[model samples]
Target: MTAFCATGAFAADYVPGELVVRIPPGGNVQAIHDAWGTQTLEQLSLRSYVVTPPAGVNVEDCDQWLDADSNVESADPNWITESPEAKSAIIIVAIGSSTTQYTDQGAFARIGLAEAHQYSTGQGVRIALLDTGIDPSHPVFQGKLIAGYDFVDDDADPSEIATGVDEDGDGLTDEGFGHGTMVAGVIAASVPDAEILPIRVLDDEGSGTLASLIRGIDYAVSRGAQIINMSVGLAFESEPLENAVSDAEDAGALLVAAAGNENTPTEIYPASFGQVLSVTALDSNDVKASFSSYNEEVDVAAPGDGIYSTYPGGTYARGSGTSFAAPFVTGAAALLFSAGTPGEPGDLAQSLTDSVVVVDSLAGNAPFAGNLGQGRLDVESALTGYLAEQATSVDGAFRPYGVQFFASPNPFRGATTIRLSTPAGTTMPHELEIYSLQGRRVRTIRSDSSDRGAWEWNGLDDRGRHVSAGVYLIRSNAGSLQSVGRLVHIR
Candidate 1:
């Protein structure tokens, strides 16, 4: 391996002990570390490693040394920065002892979630909240939260702590103490039953390193998170950060991030990544929030101005920013996932983009129209539109809300593959039973023990007799959940 000097901030000289580096695929990270006379600290992913150099070495020299080897992608200092906690303007309404109703306010009805709630409550969906720790004891999250890890404190208690120290040196102390709890509240409002997994990537001051963010992503994916809500982002580009986002997407988890509140189109990590669904903020008037960042990467918009949601200490507060806007989409996606919606991540994302109602107030306004994404989120429209599409299929069957098992090449010449989309890391006994339209069992097939399993059918009855060319019903039974789909067989 040969090192290639990377330009920019890496060119600066600084005393360094630890660094984050990405090694080439299938290469020995340990051997590479030994060649550089460094000790391995941890492995972020299969190809990403954290190592520290021997005494008297600077970060700039280490970059140059690692760049000389061809097995390295890029090596940079273990850079630390606050999660994009930059909100353009925040109107914080203190929570007193008088509030009881949190989601009954205008934000719920404005986004059309009140109507959407009748259909799905985001049950059985696991959403990973990557931000400041959450207060799980809050009544709104009484039975909604799952145990999550705290990367900042390296403990199991992922609860928000109050520290008056300005860890980010932003001239503020504990600015992000209750940020994660608020984000979780917005999601609950839309998908009240979705399981909230609070992964604390940011500290009490709302500050953390890129390495910590990467660790949070790794943890979320391993735990089978269907949707990851990152109400945080980084300003500058980092290869390690980008690679982590790609890893999450490849694992079949949907990534959602908040567009910066800097009021500029400047891109932010994870949010800018192609695999992530970036969200911008909007106000109750159905207009773009004055502070939401405008960019080509923005995929959807949600209410962010003066949004009312759950706060720490078992109270409700009104806050505003793109940070709060993102959970609405997260919750909406969770609702679909829990309903056993079948489609790739991109397919699900397209459903949302198509369901957005174009606003006349913002259309042709050039700036807002071009950058505010399709339009503000309408959960009722998105869910109704998705199910409506399913009902109009070839078989005219309704597969409403349940487990999803569908087959391709329905009009099969001889055989077809049935794909099952289950919750991540789920392994259970299931069988695919094919039957004639007249209710005679044709063939029974079993799926592999994995979240995503597949099986094939050969148009034959249990006696190995070729059934007459006709339509067949394929039903997938997994414990208490079952889904029915149609198939056409021709002789």
Candidate 2:
């Protein structure tokens, strides 16, 4: 393996309990277009989300993730300033490049996921591609597409015509490039057995209004789509859209969103919402994508740089952005869901995070502690982990609130950090108190205004005094809400 350069980020080892976070993508529509040109989400994001996992996973392929000539280090300067923490090793896109006709790598190439093929390509699963409209006759969709409704015109034949068959008498086909067709190819194409529900939410401009996305979400839920891949996201997070996603989650559907390529920590929605799994892209190294979002909004990472996949007009092209990486995670999720793994969206979410293997350590991936949350998605590993965890029944009391917490560099030397979440717009003061193992209160820190979405603390007492090396507890209080986390201070 090639030597990896250090980015001062620690390697996020693949621990079974760790959550697979696909953070590190651009934040929203504007940012995504800023990363790429003016492209639509349903095409860029959903197509990747709906596709199937590659034939197999392997260490050698992971090695390619680190190669300088690999996807992560392409010509796109959007992330040139950002580097993967691991060495030449990296988390590569398991599937072939769209430039390669989005075809399956020969049997010899898919050695990474040797056992993955044993499972189905989610053939029977129905993934509704809500974008412009699909070319129903695409070779990949030979027999995989199902009858879909074009809400834009309320038409039965929802083709990507100059105007979609205005299903709702809106006299508009929605706005978008030929994205629906691309997205359908990713999902149903990869999993030939999987069926597609093509719903056009946008017009021909490759853009759609907020209302259109909400309606599209509702449409997918009604169609019994086990996996609804939403590759597009808005610049601003809307409460109405979030509520619709909440309903989708309640309806036993998996919604995959693309983390925008903003090159900062800004988060895009519905991917950044409380429960949604926001996916980011990685070159070979397991590092926080420079254009990817951070600050806990991201849940996992996948391959997105210089990604090759199916394009319009039966062509293939290579593109970069978090939009491409989302499908890998979505495909993995579909595979797991089809396998009948049991759990709530949260549990399934956790298992998915725990299932992937950190592939980037060679291409300077050691320092990205949480950049590529839970590393790259490993088909067999994720499936295996999901099945194993399924056997272990619920062990703890259920968490009533949707917030989550974490402590990085757990057994810390200089400083141990703790982060807390209490949703957005909470009208209450929160505090994080530190106590010694003996239950003695040593320090008290309150959640100031900076605790917008979540709060964090480096292992220290109220007086800015570092504590002794031992076990401690961080008690979180958000007005009426309370939670606790065990802390271990080292050195």
Show the lowest summed lDDT stretch of 10 residues, model 2. 74-83
Over 336-419, each residue of candidate 1 has an lDDT whose tens digit, in order, gives 665434567776787787898676366433566668778888887887666555432232232443356567775565888877
Alpha carbon deviation, residue 175, candidate 2 (Å): 11
Task: Give every collision pair in model 1.
Answer: 1-69, 1-70, 2-68, 2-69, 2-70, 3-67, 3-68, 3-69, 4-67
Predicted model with the maximum lDDT: 1
User: Backbone clashes in each candidate structure, one number apiece?
Assistant: 9, 76
Report, for every candidate in turn, its global Cα lDDT versus the true structure: 0.74, 0.53
Cα RMSD, each candidate: 11.2, 22.6
Displacement of the residue 391 alpha carbon in candidate 1, Å: 3.0
